[model samples]
Target chain A: MSLIQFFNVTKQYPPNITALDDVSVKIDKGEFVFLVGPSGAGKTTFIRLLFREEVPNRGQIIIGGRSISRLKRKEVPLLRRNIGIVFQDFRLLPDRTVFENVAFALRVVETHPREIKPRVEKALAQVGLSNRARMFPHQLSGGEQQRAAIARAIVNNPGILVADEPTGNLDPATSGDIMKLLEEINRLGTTVIMATHAWDIVNSMRKRVIALQHGRLVRDDREGGYGYEA
Target chain B: MKLRTAGYFFRQAALSLWRNVWMSLAAAASVAISMFLLGAFLLLVFNVNHIANNLQSNVEIAAFLQVDVPRQVSLHIQDQVRALPGVTEVTLVPKEEGLQQLSQQFGSEQDLLAATGGVNPLPDYLRVRVADPQSIQSVAEAIKAIPGVEKVNYGQEVVERLFAVVRWLRWLGVGIIAMLGLGALSLIVLTIRLAVYSRRREINIMKYVGATDWFIRWPFFLEGLWLGLFGSGVAALAVYLGYRLVLNMVGPAAVFVPLIRDQGLLLWSTLGLVAGGSLVGALGSLFSIRRFLKV
Candidate 1:
């Protein structure tokens, strides 16, 4: 069964400006999907809609058979809890240490204190940042900071992880490393849907690729590479 | 069973509190100053109201008797005064008794009174009180018309003036305190907003991470509560201690009638201040979050 189904989704900002128009797609459970397009290709909007950050103007988004548009406002949080989100800017709390930043995800979900520590440590270890758990965000390198953010995103044991431009800030070497880490996370039974505009990573990986252009889904291909021609 | 959740809520509250210690302190201090000003103004209004009530209840129309008036005639006039309209009570004081009362009133100046040397110059009079304070003038006139009554000295003009002054004062105190309370609310709210803005990134992150709006809102609520709780506590202590110092200093001098005669009332007032402080803090935090910290 499909874990995520977007049915004719349309998102408009203002004055007839459409971000995502009548986009329909299905992502199966445990799938590794890459969302690729230019800067204004509605990739952020797609990720945001999955998390129910903003409601689509006209369409239904189904996750695990639950309809996003049909869900009440109060139910959005529970839906969000099952989905992990990482961002380009890292979004780490400046004051919190790496450990605390990861643990905050568990804390927000009211995870037991005893359960929180082990879960956070495991997430840190998964992201290869176990040793730097005590360091603040600013003290870490850009790659390390993104790792901490990934740890934070997955600490709550989300079934699906959505990363929006997670490698947008890192160098090519570091970006490849982050990509491997995400692939490892995907291998461990968590579905990974990453949004990026990087041609090299997407081309080299040749994963299931979904392409968007001018708010429309241009391509949905298996083992696809980057670029409009491909 | 719910202790774990409670623990998390408070733990988060404390963590965030310490994270922005300076802003928290400023928010707390602003609340404290607001609560203090409100409390002090409250104390003033209460004491003034108390004094005014005492003076008003004690106000009377005094009708002096002529020199060597017959006891039977004075008794008859007393009975007639009692029958007068709006007269609540009429108590007759003999010359000797009246003189004694005067001597007691001038407690420190008893030596000066003793220099009069048994002359018994004080006049016998009937003290008349009216049921309605506003009708004192008519009551005084009626008392003066009674046969064998020499002169009427109700201090009606003075008492009316005092009532007017006291009424004006009550309103003025209320107006000032109300304005000050609003000032405190706005100031604390502004400070809390600053605190909220400082944590805007944290809030955005929380929302993105699937935190319920309440989960995002609770720590801020707790922060505000702590600010109010601590602020009010400080204000109550300051005002109470300050009041005690003033009372102790001025009480011995006997320069004026004691304003706050009831010490127990201060305890109640302190409790009120604490409650108000908490309210202000919580409300300030709520307003700040609602206005500035969008979940």
Candidate 2:
């Protein structure tokens, strides 16, 4: 079944600038899709709409068959629980240790304290940071911080992981390693939608790609290369 | 939330307070100073008002009769004054008894009486105690209209002056207490705001982590509570100690003033200080966090 559906979605900001214009797309459960576009091409807007952070100016967004466009403020948190987000900045809380950072997501959901430790340990292990659980965010390398962020995002086993420029700040080798980790996560039947500007990474992945330009979906292809030319 | 879980927030708040000990100390010190001054002023006002009321109770109206009046008429005047509204008691002091009492009062100073003691020049009088000291003026005026009453003396000027002083002290006490409260509130707000500002990164991370608004706010709210409670508790202790010290220095003769006699009032004041401190801290945190937590 399709996990996410955006039908005729258009997001206009103020007088004249449109961030996403009549962009309709759909992704099945467990599908891995890359959203490829140049800067200012509304890729972030697409991810935000899924989280209901920014609602569409027109049309609808359905996640897991529920219309997210009309979800109340109280319901937003529940929707977010089903969708994990990773940012380029690696937004790990500096005050918390790596283990605590990952455990925080479950804490917010009021999971039993006894169950939190094992889940946190398992998530950290999956991210290969089980040994560095005691280390604070500032003590970690850039790639390690991003990995910690991913660990936090996935700890609750969210059905969908939306990553915006997850590899933007990493070297090509580190970026490739992060992509491999994401692919492994997708193999576990979790949908993955990554927004990025890296053409080489997209071509190498050989996954379905959706391209956006001027806020409109310009192209959608299976096993596609990055459509934007330098 | 269960009490045990709520306790976790308290623990977190306490740890944060300890981590920022210097700033916390500064905030607490400000609260203590303000509350102490305010509590002291309240103590003074309470005692002074008590003293004035006690003194006023002792004062009464004394109406002197005409020297040539018949003894029966003087008796009738006393009975009439006693029957008036708010008149509690009336004692008629005849010329001889009045002179004897005057002599006894000045007996230690023989020179005070040597020149004046031939035939007892003081007139006979009816001393009247009223149910209400505040009705002295009206009572005195009523006595003056009685036939054969030569003069009425109720010490109205002295009573008015004493009441004026009490009124001034009351207003001054209120003004000082209000200023102290405002100062404490502003200090708490600023302190909590600073603490929030320092943790902005943590707040930003929490926002994107899908944490609910309440989850993000609980820690800071708890932090404010800790600061307020500790600060006010210290202030109350200081006020209590200061009261004891002042009582000892002034001695038991000050009982007429009753500076610390009403232990219940002091206890309530202490509780009020602590509650006020906690409330101020909570309010400050709430105000500071509102801007950051908006979706």
Candidate 3:
């Protein structure tokens, strides 16, 4: 079985709004994939289902040999622990320093105090944010804040990294820098899946791209380009 | 959980509590206000009950004898009264002594009695004490049925009225305390709910980062605990000081009417209030945070 599989999945909201309809896909370990679509294209729903944030309405989702479509409420956290999530707004705690923000991920899981510092330092270094550890989120630039958020996500060394428009708030140059960091993390054998509307980055990386249109999977390309215009 | 984990929760709780200092204070103040009222009512109830018990225990049935009843008959009646069920003791007051006591109550009005031709219209009576105040009416009725007894009086109207007042006061105290307690509980819940709502974005981030539900809960729980502790602590102090002040201010004037002055009782009651405050605060916080955890 593939590492992450969605078999004939359908998700619907109230009053007849179908987010993902009868979609089936498989993603293996150590594979970088991009989820490409316009707004309301079910890309966010797909990511939500991957993390068990929302369960499918009519199918099975398997992650790491476990069927998560009907996973227990208590076990949802366990599933999420193996996955790292990034958002467009860079959801770092405003009151905490960058180092504290990264360490927060470990602290919640009751990691020892002695190990929190070094692991946070290493994650910050991975994002090239070693010197900005003492700064707060507001004190950092837009790119730096995203970098801090990325550092927090990867600090747990999760097997899967999912980013939803991580570069949506940054300039083109900074977006490229963020993409390079994600690629480096992927090269380290962590499966990276990013959702984006950045055509240039999509065409340049040429990684696996899965396109969704109106809740249906339209194409799965091993080396896809920005087939649609911005 | 590790000590380090506990320390982390405590630090986080402290930080958030400081961040929302105004809201936290408001919740704590509500708890304090409710607890203070509760403590005051409790003290009132305890003291009133104590005074009532004292008065009831001292109730004595006075069985007045028939006019011209022989002394031998009066002595026999006293013996019979002492033998009756629940009768603790009986003492006879001769007609001469009754007249003497009445004159003494008149207090230096000897000339008035002299003007009445030296005639004493007083009757001999038996003072009857019972084991239980609750049985005073029944015992009085029994004594009235005895031969040679003209009437039985235990100050029936006065005693009944006093007991009614005590009962009413007790019920009123309970009702007021209950209403205040509910008000405090909801206020704390509302304040904590607002606190939770304000921090919901932070909570969502925590959830996305794989933090367990309990992990997100601990800090908030600790915050509630502190609010309860501080609020109730202040309330307990206020109640204690207020009681002490009242006692000192009214102690000498209320010498004839017994008031509760046991330091140990006051201390225990204040401590109980503090405990209740803390529990309410903690449970309120936990309840308020439940829906927000769905994220």
Q: Rate the local accuracy (lDDT) of all candidates.
A: 0.84, 0.84, 0.88
Model 2 C-alpha lDDT per residue in residues B1-295, reported as the tens digit of each score: 7565567667767777777788888887878888778777778777777766677778988899998888899999888888889889899999878877887887833554456675456778998888877787888899999998999987777778878888998898888878877777777777777877877777765666677777778888888877778888898898888887888888867855545567788788878878877887788778878988765
A118 in model 3: Cα distance from truth in Å? 2.5
Scanning candidate 1 chain B in windows of ten residues, the lowest lDDT window is B252-261
**Would you list the rank order by DockQ, best first?**
3, 1, 2
Cα error, residue A167 of model 1, in Å, equals 2.0
CAPRI docking class of candidate 2: acceptable
**TM-score between predicted and true chain B, model 1:** 0.72
Model 3 steric clash pairs? none
Candidate 1 chain A lDDT trough over 10 residues, lowest sum: A104-113
Model 1 reproduced share of reference interface contacts: 0.64
Per-residue error (Å), model 3, residue B17: 3.1
Evaluated on the second chain alone, the candidates' TM-scores are 0.72, 0.83, 0.85
Candidate 3 regions off by >4 Å? A69-74, A216-230, B63-87, B90-126, B135-152, B190-198, B253-255
Query: Which window of ten consecutive residues has the lowest lDDT sum in model 3 chain B?
Result: B107-116
| Clashes per candidate, residues 3 or more apart or on different chains | 0, 0, 0
Q: Distance from true position, residue B24, model 2, in Å?
A: 1.5
The residue pairs found clashing in candidate 2 are none
Give the per-residue Cα lDDT of candidate 3 at B110: 66
Docking class of 1: acceptable
Which regions of candidate 1 fall more than 4 Å away from where they truly are? A14-16, A69-74, A93-97, A129-141, B1-27, B61-87, B90-157, B249-258, B291-295
